[model samples]
Target: MNAIAAPAAADDNGLETGLNATLREPISADGTPVLGKTYTVPARHGRAVRVKAGQTIRIANPHGTQVCDTWIFNAEHLNEFLSFEHTRAYIDRIIPQPGDPLVTNHRRPIAELVADTSPGVHDTLMAACDLYRYRNLGVEGYHDNCADNLRLALKAIGLRTREVPQPFNLWMNIPVKPDYSVEWLPPVSKAGDYVDIKAAIDCVVVMSACPQDIIPINALNPLDVEFTVLDPAVSSHS
Candidate 1:
């Protein structure tokens, strides 16, 4: 599948800029409330929604430094498509410096590293935070994380959580150093800068606005995020 590269101007120094806002919706803690086709993502967390080909999903880091890891999967086949290993391999193979298109396992374009909105880019090598990782990180008491949200999203679609893999973290900044070491940095996204994706196929997109307060990533405070869908005509051209 042909992938359109997200322009470097869009994501200057991992900072969100030049994003035009069209709509805003609130996500509650219980879950994303249904508002027609729009989904509300609660504060300090994330959610996933299904989008058909030709549809577009727009996510905003309503509160800066809100890290959201996303994943796209074929709704029909469900077993194949965006694989984390493949995505990492692709990124490693190309060694994208900045402003590169991230491809899925099927070679389908998933997302472009359009805007970083942070001084440090999040790790593509590190998987999503799970119970195991949380415990290892000395935050065993924390039960809720991006992994839990993904599991819930899978259940919402009548799919098993185990079937899902680690998702791509959007807006989160974990920069790689010259020595190839990774470090988590504070978010560079402001109140409104958003990351937009146009679907290439009928797929389920999942995200978790990271709730980890132990680090500086969220400024030690979790805040709400917004999700919206734009008309194809507008989103594609805008």
Candidate 2:
């Protein structure tokens, strides 16, 4: 592994790596923030960050309660999108673990999970919050949702709503009960909990600071989250 260009990745520590039960944190060192900037996504808004090949983006729940609905795309190819179905097909488990690649529709790996500190509670089965969903749920009026936020954020890059693919809910806790039905649950991620993904190829990452207040997904409230893009090329090995 190119330690100078790529931090410890999933290939270095396999998915079976366990987290300390008392306190979970980032997989590898936070490293030096060199290549990109850190963006604070305020509540009810979305943001996009682009990174080159081999860079790592760390999405963190600073408050430990907010969920970030995230989507990925190949910067050069619009047709290829993030496909949870294919990702599930590649792994034996539904929830991502360290070393799992977030694959594109063609099964191309764009990002791989290098480390996570939230007790492995993420949801790949649910769709982003949308107005239609709110309306169906008997919401009184228009409400903020992750879907629209994602579209608004992607617009800056010339992608339309149709191209905004399904998201990977980071730090979300949606569990399936024994009845085979799913239920929204509060996240277990504490403050400073984060998940790091090493970009295998150049890709655009879109995230909604999840405005899901109607459910317990965000603990019935929405808050801000933090995004950090780490350039391993300038980082020193420990």
Candidate 3:
């Protein structure tokens, strides 16, 4: 029989690695939002909202410089989430275009990129920033980070994910160089630019206005972003 190595001592519980305001506020008790109302994800904070199948979520870059770290999870099964690796393979591109299907770890379409008002420049390669990342940057005390924001956001809405998957970094530019290196650059999107993601299945969408002041990303000034859930029926009925 083969021997299995025991895991190292660590905080493995699916809870917030640390705390922040993201734990206090949820768009709603269960992460539900008004059908057509816009909600703000404050700078250095995160928010989660539920999107039903056939509904679309429009995330706006009011400042254009703010980077939004995004994630989508199947409402029924947290383990099934939008997987960038699978999505990149599914779409045959690292950056998904407006028409591309956002695929999940199960190799199924969980959401579709319905519209993109800005230049198609988003990142799928970088892990969401964490407390350790801040520590490495010489930040003392607690720092608000996307990884913890994700955890606390979900926890705020009575949900938890065992793993923190790589997020779809919306409006986050990391251009690849000729030598295969990448540069973290500011977003090219302009104010009012937005992307609309339509749910292929019932899912929860989370957004973190990345708090990375140490880097050029977010233009070194993290700011708030907004989102709204658009119900197709409303437009159709009106």
Q: Which number leads on lDDT?
A: 3
> Between the candidate structures 1 and 3, which one is better when assessed by TM-score?
3
lDDT of each: 0.56, 0.72, 0.89
RMSD of 1: 12.2
lDDT of 1: 0.56
**Top TM-score: which candidate number?**
3
Clashes of each: 17, 0, 0
Question: What would the TM-scores of all predictions be?
Answer: 0.71, 0.81, 0.93
Put down candidate 1 lDDT per residue, 215-238, tens digits, no spaces: 777777766676665565545423
Error of 1 at 140 (Å): 4.4
Candidate 2 lDDT, tens digit per residue, 16-37? Answer: 1111110111212221233656
lDDT of 1 at 175: 73
Give candidate 3's error at residue 120 in angstroms: 1.2
Candidates 2 and 3 compared by lDDT, better number = 3
lDDT of 1 at 213: 74
Tens digits of lDDT, candidate 3, 100-212: 99999999999999899999899999999987788889977677889888988999999998889989999999999999999998999999899999999999999999999
